[model samples]
Target: MRFVNDRDPLPLIEQLRRRYQDQRQIAYVERAGDAVVIDFTVHPAAATQGCGGANGTGCGCSGG
Candidate 1:
């Protein structure tokens, strides 16, 4: 997933880390003017390890 934000996304990145643990990874793709771009990558093995939805985002899972 590509994230485009108006400002630095440090807090959001921290939250992603807490939510997904090592299951997901992120990297800075770009930082131009007011746009901050980040790539959120999810490992395939992260799918079957938790109680969240198919993408493991806890959107539709009762275990959240």
Candidate 2:
């Protein structure tokens, strides 16, 4: 598991869901009384966006 910020260079959860182009997982949380209900989606690819890493972020894809 990982945490991402709104400004992260990687991508938004929504974006990743789209780019994967395959079965993906999504985590979400909801409030129920005093407890939080965590939920997940088994598939997200069909709803994700095509980023291509696609924007050439200069992260050095070769694992620098």
Candidate 3:
């Protein structure tokens, strides 16, 4: 299946939702005061820290 690139938030969000569905557990959205939070509350140990993009092995974590 081919995924069409959506520049908008909803489609992008949904795409990510499906991608991590099995491995990551729950994914949801909520209001975090002034800003919106797209919570990717994942499996704690499974998630790794993002690479600084210098070493090139970015762990695909948030900071990356």
Candidate 4:
């Protein structure tokens, strides 16, 4: 599990998902002030523990 901070993570995440497909695991994103924080987990077992969808839905973990 690692955190990647970006002003906009959608484009990058989309590209990554397309390039890696199922090889990549869960991806969670949240708004942090003016920027978006993206958390990417490569471990398949961690997928179930991840929050949010590929479309960036169901993300209440940030308290936003």
Report lDDT (CA) for all predictions: 0.75, 0.42, 0.45, 0.59
By lDDT, rank the candidates, best first. Answer: 1, 4, 3, 2
| lDDT for each residue of candidate 3 in 1-64, tens digit (9 for 90 to 100) | 1223223246666665555543344333444444444444456544453332323444466665
Q: Which candidate has the top score in TM-score?
A: 1
Pitting candidate 3 against candidate 4, the one with the higher lDDT is 4
* Candidate 4 worst ten-residue window by lDDT: 50-59
Task: Tell me which residue pairs clash in candidate 3.
Answer: none
lDDT of candidate 4 over 1-64, digit per residue (tens): 5655656666767787765455466455677766666666565643565644345553466532
lDDT of 1 at 49: 56
Residue-level error in angstroms, candidate 1, position 34: 1.5
Q: Can you list the residue pairs that collide in candidate 1?
A: none
What residue runs in model 2 are displaced by over 4 Å at the alpha carbon? 2-11, 30-64
Model 4, position 15, has a per-residue lDDT of 80
lDDT of 2 by residue, 17-36 (tens): 55543344655454445444
Total clashes in model 2, counting residue pairs 3 or more apart in sequence or in different chains: 3
Report the number of the highest-lDDT candidate: 1
Model 1, position 53: C-alpha lDDT score: 40
